[model samples]
Target: MIKGTVKIDAKICKGCELCIISCPQDGLGLAAQFNDKGYRYVELIEDNCTGCVNCALVCPEAAITVFRQPKPAKKSVEKK
Candidate 1:
């Protein structure tokens, strides 16, 4: 599994829910509170993330960024 994190650029978000419907994992959503611009911005429910990067793909402003954690190192097998 990828260790993924989603970031919402509050300055650029227009409170639209298009990314919400586009996310296959339901990883992204609209915030209940409004920002300084008097508009609601998107936020991430990090625990539910599947790292598909769907939110980034759907964002019109290219404001979202997803960071994936590197894979864990595999253990070496011992000779029997």
Candidate 2:
């Protein structure tokens, strides 16, 4: 399976839950601490992200960035 992750710009996030709601994997959540803007920022709470870009698409501040790593290709055995 393809692995995924996200980076959130805490400084710019306005604590909107739109990204959290749009996340199919339920990987996002609000941080315990507040950002520079005094808003609780969204963060990756789980490792089940699939990099679907759903969170990024729904983010009004464009603070979320998703990265996807492709599954490794399998090696085939040679027939003698």
Candidate 3:
């Protein structure tokens, strides 16, 4: 399972809700408070993000940034 997260630039976000709708994991939501631009910004509502980049792709303002955790390394067995 790939664990991931996202960061949103609240100052520039216009509360378009495009990212929220594009998110497949339901990890994003609009903030209750407004930003300096007087628009509610997007936020991570769940910890189930997979860094799919869907939200970022749909964001017109390009305010969302997705970060994915690296996969674990596989252990190798040495031949005796």
Candidate 4:
């Protein structure tokens, strides 16, 4: 059950790394690159996210958001 989840507002983000440390599950990280404002952005790693939304709550910039992945659709079988 692997998925990508992390919503960030680049314009509002100041790259403080507060979200990085706040994550109890270690989901958030500082990306290798910077945004248009030259601020290092945050990203989510699959093995890391527990969807606690700790990062979202601690973010002073209101830049981070977490979402749960949608469940897979079930298949229908035909009967004779």
Best by lDDT: 2
Q: Which pairs, if any, clash in model 1? A: none
- How well does each candidate superpose onto the true structure, as a TM-score? 0.77, 0.86, 0.86, 0.68
* lDDT of every model, 2 decimals: 0.78, 0.88, 0.87, 0.72
Residue pairs clashing, model 4: none
* Regions of model 4 farther than 4 Å from truth: 1-4, 69-80
Clashing pairs in 3: none
| Model 3 local distance difference test score | 0.87
Give one digit per residue, the lDDT tens place, for model 2 in 1-80. Answer: 56889999999999989999999888899999999889999999999998999999989999888898754442222222
Q: Which stretches of model 1 miss by more than 4 angstroms?
A: 72-80
Cα deviation of 28 in candidate 2 (Å)?
Answer: 0.4
lDDT of 4: 0.72
Q: lDDT (0-100) at residue 61 of candidate 4?
A: 86
TM value for model 3 = 0.86
Task: Provide the global lDDT of candidate 1 against the true structure.
Answer: 0.78
**Backbone collisions counted per model:** 0, 0, 0, 0
RMSD of 4: 4.8
Model 4 lDDT tens row, 1-80: 43436788876788898888887777667778888888887776536575667788989988877776544431222221
Candidate 4: residue 53 lDDT (0-100): 72
